[model samples]
Structures are given as C-alpha cells and as structure tokens.
Target: MDIFSNHKRLFLLVILLFGTLTVFVAIFPALNNQYSYEPLPDSIPLTEIEQRGKMVYIGNGCVACHTQQVRNVEIDKVWGSRPNVAADYAGIERTNFWVNTATLMGTERTGPDLTNIGKRQPSEDWHLTHLYQPRAVVENSVMAPYPWLFELKDSIKITEKDKIVNLPARYIKDKSKKVVATEDAIALVAYLKSLQQVKLPDGTPSPEFLYKREQKKHGANESGGSSALDGAELYTNYCASCHQTDGKGVSGAFPPLDGSAIVQGIDPTSMVNIIMYGYNAREEYGEMPAIGQINDLSLEELVALMNHERTSWSNDAPEVSLEEINKILEELKKQNENQ
Candidate 1:
C-alpha cells in the first residue's frame, strides 16, 4: 500500500510482463507449427527464377482467383490427392532474413486450386498460351491476358523455344508480329511449376476420394444405357467446365463439341489426339488443354468421352474402341519422338 516503497519492485514486474508477451507473440507460432512438420518425398527448394516468379504471381493478384490451400472436404478431389498439410510448404525459402511470404493459402477459389498445379498441369506450353490470352485456352475465362509477357508472332527469326505459345488464329492482332516469350513469362511459369504439394509423411494415410467418387459419378443421359461410368463421369468432372454440359461451348471462347466436325469426323484418331495433346487450330476459338493426358484418363475413359460426345446433340459417330484409342495415342507418341 506504500506507493513509493515498491517503485523498484513495480519496474521489475513490468519488464517481466513485456518479455513474456514478446516470447508468446514470436516463439509460439514456430513451436505450434513444429508438430505439423513432416518431410515430404521429392521436395525441392525454389531456384532464383522460381523465387522471382513467386513475386510476379503475388504482384499479379493470382491469389485473388486461385487458392493455394487444398481443403480436407470430399468435394476437393479435383485439386489434389490429399488435403494441404504444413509440411507441404515446409521447404518454402525465406524471402529476407526473417520473412517467409510463400504461404498465401487463400480462401477464395474463383479459379481452380493451385496447390498441386505443378503436378496436375505441368506443361509450360499450356501455361504460356493460357497466360497470353486466358480466353485463348479457357473459354469463358475471365482472367486477364498478360500480352506484355509475349511478343507478336513473325516467321522471319523465331525458333520453337522462343515462340512457346500457339495461340488460336482469331486472337492475332498482327500476323507479322510473332509472339516471343519474355523473361517474366518464363519466371511466372517456373513459379507456377513449383506450386505443388508433396506426398504426406509415412504413417499418414492418403486421402481416399473413392467414397465420394461413386456418388459423383456423372452421366444420366436422355438416352441412358449400361455403359462405362468412368468416361461420362470423368468428362463431367474434368472437361465439362470449359466445354459445357451440352457441348455447345461458349461463343468466341471454346469450340463447339455438340455437332463439331472434329467430333463427328470419320477418323477418331484426330479427336483422340486432340484430347490427349491439346489444340490451337483456330485463333478465334480458345485453346484446348490436353484434358485426357493431364487428367490421366484411361484408354477406355477417353473412348467413353469420345463416344458420349459423338452420340449426344444428334450427332452420332461410330463408337470408338479402346483398341483404336490406344493406336492413335501410340502413333502420336512416335510422331512426337520423331519431331
């Protein structure tokens, strides 16, 4: 009760109080995150270019549309094999001496999740085309095109490496100007290629989506029959977003699948190749990503998707067999090797 008598005692108590608060604020997060640490296999540190690309991605507001965190929910099967864990991002390099801005785990997902994008969509060509003109690849994509990242197309002095994007014909502003990729584009692609989740630690079981898989098995058509569930279901799951339910894709964005000549063509090889390899046939239409290949669809599933597209919209093409699809895929592989 004597105010002046305990001044020294009071000063000591204040120091202790502030010191404990500082420790709680700074040290607890590191300790709390420690328990979640598990070494994932096949993990690699980011390179200098990849780090620069990360900054580009951050600067461009990619986190606004796409999320880096994969939820534990059953509906998140399309994103990755497992929900995001702390160790998946354990290898993220520190920006400065005391800063690590790699964890952007955004909540909003206007676009598809990017947690395992490097695994799901690893092709640099695809990203380049998509980045130059999002609508060029993804019909109805509201994403802004980064044309500054590329040069106009011109045949005189450009190699395949310099001209990575094979844009659809309709979007070309000037035919003389061949689009060449800039360093920022390469950096951005490298950064995106690094955004993958490594496998979970040992003893931690992988997330099994088979439970929800069957429940979400699509394809209850007007002309329903006992056909394979994997194809129709996979088509809806993987391709339906861009191509649409009726297959009459958005105008000026995605090409028509309902009664397309490509769909109804005699040789299934071309269509099959397109599904597996991707296309930039017309500049007007958006580019098609290699849906079958990227999604790892089986021969039977690719056949199923082809058949379903053919039969639907009153455009009946002959049913494609797995044998035929396999042949087409093999031939294409050889051609790629030859080239």
Candidate 2:
C-alpha cells in the first residue's frame, strides 16, 4: 500500500486530459468556419413538392457527385460567372440541415458542376426525360437513372382524346409491397429545376442580342460590295484549328470567338487590337501566340478575315475598314511600348 501511494498516475492522467481539451477549444472555431447555413427565399418560395424533392436529393446522395462552387479561374476560362462569394448566401437564416461535414465546405466534382445548372438547360420536360433515361439526350452522360423519384401509377385511364399524353411505365412492387416510379423519377426533376446559376453583372450584353445586331447590319450590306464569303474561306485555313469550325471552342483552352460580345460589340477598334498585337499573358485562357508576327496578311486581308469570323456561322458583327485596322495597330504599338 505504501509503495502504491507514492505513485502519481492520477496527476499524469489529469494533465493529459486538460491538454487535449485546451487544444480542441482553440481549434474548434477554425474547423467549423467552412459552411454557413442560410434561409431560402420567401417571395418565390419553395413549395411542398420542391421540399420533398430536396429530401430525395439528400437521400439519394446527389451531392456526393456534384459540387456547387465556381472559382475565379473557372469562371473566366469556362465562360461562367464570377466565383461564388459569401454575399450570395447572406440572406439565408441559419438552421440544422443534413450537411456533409467531412469536407467542411463540400466534396470534389465527380460530374459537371451544378452551381448554375438550372440556367444551363431550362426545360422541365428535358430534365424529366433525361432523369428517366439519360442516354436519350446526352449520349455520354454517366449518371444513373433515378426512376424511384417518380410516383408510379399503372393503367391510368386516358381522359382527354385531343391531348396526347405519355403514360409512365408499369410500376414494380418492392418487398414491402409499395409501388414506386418504374424507377420514382419526378421528385428528382423538381430538385434539379431549383438549382439555378447565379446572375451575371449588370450591363453585360447577351450573346444573342449582339449576334442579332450584327446580323441586321450584315443583311443591310448584303447587296453591297462586301464579301464575307472570302473571309469565311480565310478563317477555315487560319483560325479553324484553334477556334474550332463551329466557334464554340475547346472549353478552357480556346476562348469562343463566335457569340463573343467583344467580337460583335460596337467597337471595331478592340477587335483589331486583339488580332494585331495578340492578347496579354493575363488572359484566362493561355496567351494567344502573336500570329501578327507572321506578317502574311496585308491590311485588307486582315479586314476580310475579321469580317468573316465576326459574321460567319451565327455571328453578325459589322464590317470593319482598313482605316480602322491601321488606327488600332498604331494604338497597339503604343500600348506595347508602355508595357
């Protein structure tokens, strides 16, 4: 008993417990700073159907595959809006939700990012068909069909003779004797419609509007001596390899010249500047090599080429002049020297 009493095991155990508690208290705030719970909108409120669908989204583990955040580089390179900011989530009231706490913020993207999914494809019927069978629309999509999200009813009698309605497939019974969407698919569609991309900044011109104006101007000069046909041929030889024949581009590698506001905008000066001097290294996509160094095209040739690209395919930018090109080149030289 006297030998045991001389030991100090209790003192050592107390010191260890205190040290562990102290460390945890110090680090807890930093660890929990990643996610913030916010309330949804009240004006265009989420309906009971949408709420049920959200529950299904969580239960099905959709977040395991998709991420919502878009970084700054991602926005510029992918033609997406600016990176997500905390102000975007400022209005939501705090409440307990089924959040993925392991990553604190969210998981890595396994599929296409869903941040602006609602805006990307805005058709409800398209989403319904895609959910029922993805291969029906996107040939390369890997997402599994979520048939269980739909309410299944068999032999629903056709009511209106004039209306052509597609019926859901026959329902299958589970071990519990419950009928489900041949896979239960509609709930997931509701959830997808709720996920909208963030709004763009004010004063940003839509590609469609810009293209229409370009077309109107081009149509006016159709009977004139202008020749976009020659421009088109030149583009095929010089530009098609990097910009692609369609003009949509290779995503993150080549910036889309077609439907680009800068290409179709009122300023022909900017267009000449970009073509003559090449873009600076600060561009989101890698710097375009200085093709102007080749010195192959004369002033008129460059004008024809620019007109062809701006008005080719669905583009409609106004025709540029040789005078405009010379002015832009002079300005570009000055800017280069200043750099």
Candidate 3:
C-alpha cells in the first residue's frame, strides 16, 4: 500500500514487470527461433529483380488479399504439398533496415495462398495479364486492375524490347494500342514467381497435413473403379483458376479446352504429356505449367482429369483408362532417364 502511494516507485515497478514479461514471453522465444532455425537446403535467395518486385508487392498491398503461408490442414493441401515450418521463413530477410515485413504470412486469405504460386502458375504472360486486369483472365474476379504497371503504346517501337500483352478485344479499348508491362510489373511477376516452396533435403521427412478429409469419388466411368479420384473436383481446384468452369479459357490468354483438338483428340498421349510436361504456345496463348508433375497426381487422378477434359464441354472423346495412363507414364519415365 505504501509503495502504491509512491507514484515514482509504482511507475518504475510497472515498467520493470512489463519489460520482464516481454523479454521472457516474447523477445526470448523470437530470438531463439531466429538463431535456431535455418532455411531448407533447397531454398534460394531472391534475385535483385525479385527483391524489387517484393517491394512492389508490399507497396501494392498484395498481402491484404493474398496469403504467403500454407497452414497444416487438409483444406490447405491445394496450396502446398506439406505444412509450413519455421525454416520455410528462415531465409526471408527484412525488406530494409527501417521496414521488415519480409515474413508476410498475412492474417487472412481473401485470395488464394501464394506460398507455391511460382510452381502453380509459372507463366509470366498469364501473371502480367492478370495484373493488368484480373478479370481479363479470371472472370468475376474482385481484384482491381493495376493499369499503372503497364503502358499502352500505339505500336511497339523498333528499340522496344519490353514484352507485349495481347488483351481481349473487349478489354482493349483500342486495338491498335499494345499493352506493355513496365519494369515494375515485370519485377512484381518475378517476385511472385519466386514464391515457391523450397523442398527439404533428401531423407528429410516432410510434415504431414492434419485432419485429412475423406474425398468421395467423382463417380465411376465405364472403365474406372470407385477408387478413381474426382476429376471434376481436381479440375476445379487446379484448372478452374485459369480455365473457367465453362471450359472456355480466357481468350488470347488461356487456350480453351472446350473445343481444343488436343482435349478431343482420338489419342490421349498428347493430352497426358501436355498435362505432365506443360505446354508453351507463347505466340498463341500463355504457357501452361506442368500441373501433374507439380502435384504428383496419381494414375487415378490422371485418368479422371483426362476423362473430365474429354467428356466435358460437349467435347466427345475416348476416355483414358488407368492402364493406358500408367503405360504412358512408364514411357515418359524411361524417356526422362534416357535424356
């Protein structure tokens, strides 16, 4: 009671207690984590361009809508292969001496997590177009366009080396003007592309996702058994982001599977190979990433995905069987080994 009556003494005591609590509860643990954790063996530092792009990402408030972390939950499986660990972020350094929002794990995911976006969508053209106008690629997207990151030129100059983006007729007010991504946009795309999950060293067991939910089959085909994965669900998760639900991909950006010759071809070899190895049709459309290889999709998944593409969007084609896909995979593996 006497000490409480002494104002100076009370203030000093409160300050000391607060400091002690902060040190023991907050500072000490943070320091320990900083010192003990090391980046994964496969982790690579960002290039100078990527660093600049990271700053642009910060300045544009991308963290407000997108998350960088993939939580340890079954639902988060689409974002990453495994749960995030402290080591995942150990390589990240401060943006600068005065600003240190490098570990931008984000509070909530308004958009999808960007933890593995580089691996997920590696097409620079797609990203550039998306940034120019989100709705250009993704219909009904709520993201605002960053038109400032591009320049609309009547014609590309002979000296101009900047890559040009071919937008949809509706999006481009003037057909004569070519949309060019500025240095900032290029840097930002580079940064986004750098946001890949670093693989753990060989023999290191990856963290498991908890609370795994039992997935139901997408229904059996004539040849597929009940064990067949739901191709529709897989497509929705992986393909729907670029190829719309209607199978009509963004014009001039993503090629449509609705009437694609590859999707409706008599032979499934080309389609399967494209899904596994990815396709680059830069002159016609944005490059497609190797979704199958990145996700390590199983035979059932491959069959389902192929069947869905073949049967969907009024495109009639022969559905692939697991046996066929497995044979193709074997051939691909041998080819890779030989290469």
Candidate 4:
C-alpha cells in the first residue's frame, strides 16, 4: 500500500524494468557474437552506377507500382526461382548507424513483383524502351512513360557517348528526330538490373531447396525435349511473358497475333522473315525482336508457331510447308539484291 502510494518508487521500478528489458532483449541479442556463426556471404554488391540508379528508382516511385518481396506462396511462383528470404536483401547496407533508406520492400504490387526481374528480363533495350513508352513494349501497359529521361536527336551528329534508342519509324515520324537515352534512364535501368536475388548465405535452412527444384525442372526439360512441347506450351513458356496468352496483345504495345493479317496472309515470306530477322515500327509498335534466331528454334518449331498463330481465334489461313517458307526467304533476298 505504501509503495503504491509512492510516486518516486513506482517511477524507479518502471525505469529499472524497462531498462533491463532494453538491454537483455535488444542490446544483448545485437551483441551476441554466436548469432553470426554463419559467415558473411560472397554475394556481389551493386556498382556505384547501380546505386545511383537505385536513387532514381526511388525518386520515380517505382516501388509504388512494383514489389521487391516475393512471398512464400503458390501464386508468387512467377516472381522468382524460390520464395524470398531475408538474405535476398542482406546486401542493402545502412545509410548510417541510425538511418537505413534501402529497405525498398514495398507494400503493394500495382505491377509485377521485381524480386528477380534482373535475371528474367536482361535486355537493356527492352527495359529502356519500356521506360520510354511502356505501352510500346507491353501493349496495354498502364505505366506512365518517363519521356523526360530521354532527349530527342534533331539531325545532330551522333557522338560515341550518345545512347541512341532504336524506335519505330512511326514513333519517330519526324526523320530529323531520333531518341537518345539519358543518364538517369541508364542509371535507373542499371538499378533495375541490380534488383536480383542473391544466392542464399551458406548454412541457411533449406538453402538449396529452390535451386534443386529448378535443376530438376531443367533435367526434365532436357529429357522430354523442346520438340515434344507443342506450340501452345512453348508460347506459354517463352512468348507469354510479352505477347500474352490471348494473343490480343498488350493493347498498344504488342500487336495482336490472333487477328493479324501477317499471320493469316497468303504469302508466308514476311512472317518467316519476321521470325528470322524480327521487325521495326509497322505503326505504333516499337520493335519485335528476332526471338526465333535468338532461341535457335527449329524449322519444325517455326512451322508449329506460325500454324498456331494463323489458326487461332477466327483466323483460317492455309498452312505453308517448310520448303515453301525457305523458297520465299531466298526470293526475298534476291529482290533485296535487285533493289
């Protein structure tokens, strides 16, 4: 009763209890050296340019649209080879002892998770193009373009340091104007390229779980083979990341293959050329990469892909043989020589 009434004693007791808790629960754990029994990993750190790019990423509020974290769940499978862990972010160092600004693990996912985007899409051209005009690459992408991060070339002599963008003729209708990437754009891309999942620190629990699963997947693919895979399945694996499943395209970014005259055209020469050499600005679309040559797709695979595209939806184009496709390609080469 006396203690309850004593204000000084109560204050002392509260201070003593809280102080002890602060030391034991917080300070002691931080000081306990055994906690670091696992050695510091040899994971690569981001370059100085990459760090600047990170600032650009932060400045542009990229985190608002994209998430850095990949949660441990079934739906997050497309994000990374494995579920994310603390080690994935261990490379981020503190700004000072008191401040840590690098904790970019976002709260929402307006866009896709960026947990392993650096590895999944390593094309600098694709990223820069996407940044310049999201819809150009992604069709109906809702992302706002960061056009300010680029400069329009107006018949100026291009220098060695100048980073020119390969846009479609339609996009740069004024022949005098050519788009060049700026430093901020380069830095931001460098930063996005740096947002990769690091190898798990040695001795972490189930460290190899995800990697083993990936190896097994590859092994199965190697045995079953790309040939055994149907065109639809192949599209799902490769093209779906860009062209999408429905083939309606990204709206303004990817051109719709479902109803494309190119796919269903009587002459398959242009289609074969597109597959081999890719294409540039037809209208609003930016550039279609030569994915066929890059992936070393077989003639059989090309035939299947074209067949699938031509026959899908309401399209009813007659199939052309491989021999016909080769002959057409050869004829096109001859025409080019005459020109």
Who wins the TM-score comparison? 3
- Residue-level lDDT tens digits of model 4 in 84-164: 765556557765698566668899988988877775554566788788877666667898989999988775667879777
**Better candidate number, 1 or 2, judged by TM-score:** 1
How far out, in Å, is residue 117 in model 2?
A: 1.1
Question: Candidate 3 at 131: error in angstroms?
Answer: 1.2
TM-score for all predictions?
Answer: 0.69, 0.42, 0.87, 0.60
- What's model 1's TM-score? 0.69
For the record, the alpha-carbon RMSD of candidate 2 to the native fold, in angstroms, is: 16.9
Off by over 4 Å in 1: 1-18, 25-36, 96-99, 119-123, 153-161, 168-170, 197-203, 208-233, 236-294, 313-315, 321-339
Pick out the ten consecutive residues of candidate 4 with the lowest summed lDDT: 214-223
Question: Per-model C-alpha lDDT, please?
Answer: 0.74, 0.54, 0.85, 0.70
lDDT of 1 by residue, 141-188 (tens): 888888888876567777757744555568777867666778889999
Between candidates 1 and 3, the lDDT winner: 3
Q: Which regions of candidate 2 fall more than 4 Å away from where they truly are?
A: 1-45, 75-80, 90-105, 151-184, 198-339
Say which candidate scores most in lDDT: 3
| Tens digit per residue, CA lDDT, model 2, 1-339 | 443465576667678888888778756653454345332232244455755566566677878887766655523223234555543444333224754322112476666666555544434545554565554444467988665555433435423321211212332243223223422245555656666544434564322211112221223233132443366655654555446677765453457788988789878777776666567554335355344443345676687778777787788977776677677877877888999
Model 1 scores what on Cα lDDT? 0.74
- Per-residue alpha-carbon lDDT of candidate 3 for residues 216-239, written as tens digits (9 for 90 to 100): 745566765225477788788678
